[model samples]
Target chain A: MALNRKVGFFKGLKYKGGGPMWAWILHRLSGLAMVFFVGSHIIAGFLTQQFGSDVGIAINIVYENWIFQLVLFFLVIFHAVNGLRVTLLDLWPALLEYQRESIWLEWLVIIPLYVLILFTVLKSALGL
Target chain B: MQKITLKLFRYNPETDTKPHYDTFELEAEPTDRVLDLMEKVKGYHDGSLSFRRSCAHGVCGSCAMRINGQNMLACKTLVQDLKTSRITVEPILGLSVLKDMIVDMDPFFDSYKKVMPFFVNDEPKPAQERHQSIEDRERFDDTTKCILCGACTTSCPSFWSNDEYIGPAAIVNAHRFIFDSRDKGAAERLQILNDQFGVYRCRTIFNCTVACPREIQITQAIGEVKKAIATGSLD
Candidate 1:
């Protein structure tokens, strides 16, 4: 039953394509993720500020870990790319079809760039 | 005195197997309404055709249907004013077609109900008709002008995606009560509307404003809801 369900999920994913519907779903998902990250970042910043010049110490204590830094980096990149796409679509709805194509292009550009940034951050963090 | 053709969408989910368009040619008067032409076609041509209309002056808002690819009150659309001689009339978008021109409005009404469209104050009602200042009442006046026409909601892409979205019409209605000084449920209403699929779903699409027959600035009302959500104050 689990294998069948996993196959059904992949099949659903395979049928999806770039369109207004897809853009809307992506926008909502990205917005939710971005809001969550921003909230946590703000709260962490506040905690650090309250704790004094240990600001770097505060950040290091929580986010100096590789996993957290990687997650934050990916979240920022995803939010920025999705936000740019939404801004374009909102400004000129006539370009909606073209924007759908550009969204895929953005993923192509963003995924590799993010991976590179993540690699660099991880390497420097580990002093590799 | 131009002869025009109207392609009317005809279907009955119970009786008909599929939807199709039936065209009718009429020598139309310049001032004749689309509703008038529909009446003529129904009376003379096809007795099986069906649609909704009442208070032909546009106030009732029961006559809203798609004309020439736009949601409009058929009674308000003058046949002569349309640029094309051939026009297509269909049911409003983002709705289930009940029959030829009628749609199932239960979904629309359900969204309104989800927003808790009535006042919810724990206090007893005042004996003297809870007096609110003119300025306080006028704040919600524009939103109150909504006639539940579904034009604004259908025009909204967000409502198109998620039919359960308490749409602009409902949000505007909720705003009516939320901003009312006498109505003490502002916080409760705000909590209901602050969900993921609530007022935040609106992407500030001006289509609602363009389609509103009552000239209500729906985008502005949605913006006000956003502001209210942000400030934690409906007033």
Candidate 2:
């Protein structure tokens, strides 16, 4: 893919410093997002299981949509990567000095991982 | 018994272009306090030297200044125990320097006042002093030991970022009243500290614990505040 202005912008956001202050801010943001999204996900799943065949129609209406799938995909990826970062920092005080570097690296790693996951989702969605 | 060298930061807002360090060589005794050395430097070496001290003891907590880059009570630190040929002293960090070894304490006290560091009891005080069980009183005893010293506050990194954090010293004081069974304003005080800049800002660095001259467990008090908030039991 050609590197466009949009890609450059996303890269800039991804590479921003993850110092202790930044880590704390991101940790809170990711945690809140995880709590809200995962809570809704569990509720929807439980409703689907309870309603059985009628719920398959509701599930198809929701899951067949690309926008909702993409949002959910990004949410899961963000929560996973940021959650791991928070866990590492909490467990290892010695890694504090390299927090900024590690944050940039996390974005570098997560972007590719998310891209692969997104590719898989699109393949399955289009039946390609 | 040995001669010691003191490197003291000197700045006079009224006259000096910028702050500078002045080194003084002095003969020291085993039991001599850091305050004693400062007094000697002011009276004999340079009469214009300025710093705050009262009671010549640790109780007043006014003599808190940076000794060898660490916040400590000048009156309580013994010269002989330092075991160093050279020592450096400066005013407390994260405060406006008023002059050499003197800082503006209004900001620190302002945080204390914001927390409303006073008792508010709905129950009328008994004609005899309000009686309390030893366990209940002990909860606040450590916090009450704070003598308004800037040591703990200055040592905290969170206070450096947010001047409004009510620092360790002030928060400990507020906790003293908040945890008291007789106090009625616990919820109000907790509300003031529940903001992004308040107790949540504390990263539990424990610098305040090491800096306290009275050996007050400042971090523990902050932890208790966290517990109170988490349990929704500030009342």
Candidate 3:
């Protein structure tokens, strides 16, 4: 198209905000968190294997911690299920018609799973 | 008469390096349309101000602009609808702005044209009128209301990022034909929309649906198109 002015670089991007946008943004953040967790995990594994007693104890401490286990569980579940949602979107673009309901459904499924994990971690943490 | 604040975007590409907002205090009734306020500004307040309007009603879709950060037909939005005395108006995004509130629409229209938005029939023309059932015509009735207003497309973030994506307006027009029972070009149109740069580019953000002046459910239509692409079924 003919132009009287170039589209504003900093300001032109303003658009209405909605569910899919937030879902995509959250997915990226969750992926980044997983990347960090995985990176530290690999390093811990390598250190534990080579350093023997000292690093092995440290790795076990973190591995057995209930708080650490809970967070790890939450992040993995969120990333995996949300990733599946993304895949469904890519393969069948029409799924967007139900995007709102799908998002609510994702929460419905994730929340019970979260609570179940919560109890499992508690049982192990307290040794009850 | 009550005084209302009109914060209009002002930019002159010829002279000004930085675009800024120009606020006009005017006498207006709470029921006056936003376009009415603008007309008053241009008619008596300052003749140098420029914006496009025809029909002075919502039918032409010429007065669409961003009011309070939402794209809507200026004629359709009432002063009281804003619920505030201060109003902020600017040109729609996803298109190059020419001046004050006018935007370069060639890119928008070109995307619509690329969809090949017309009926096609391979068989010889019927000597008599081609007949259609009410059900067949009802399938695409929602899309026929589109007036080529840039509201839906311009409000889309993907369209803002990539003008080549064949925004929602084009897709809506394509839906009008693709679902028409008498049209023989559904395959061709579907092929065009199935391209990586086509319908799949829509992120289903629903901004287009919200911004459409005709109240057309734009995202829903786009989803229907996507279903047709995936299942090989238009139902």
Best by lDDT: 3
- Per-residue alpha-carbon lDDT of candidate 2 for residues B1-235, written as tens digits (9 for 90 to 100): 7798999988887777778899999998878989999999998999999899999878988999888767899999998777787989988777777888888888899988989898898787689988789989886888888988889888766676567677888788889999898888999998888877778777755567678898877766777787687778643
Which residue segments of model 3 deviate by more than 4 Å? A1-14, A18-24, A31-128
- TM-score to native of every candidate shown: 0.65, 0.66, 0.81
Q: Which residue pairs does candidate 2 place in steric collision?
A: none
- TM-score of the second chain for every model: 0.94, 0.96, 0.97
* lDDT value, candidate 2, whole model: 0.76
Put the candidates in DockQ order, highest first. 3, 1, 2
Worst 10 residues of 3 chain B by lDDT: B202-211
Worst 10 residues of 2 chain B by lDDT: B155-164
Q: Cα lDDT of all candidates, in order?
A: 0.75, 0.76, 0.82
Local lDDT at A12 for model 1: 24
TM-score of chain A of each: 0.61, 0.60, 0.75
Better of 1 and 3 by lDDT: 3
All DockQ scores: 0.03, 0.02, 0.30
Candidate 3 docking quality: incorrect, acceptable, medium or high:
acceptable
Task: Write one digit per residue (lDDT tens) for candidate 1, span B124-207.
Answer: 877777787999888888888888888888766667667767888888888888888878888888888899888888875456
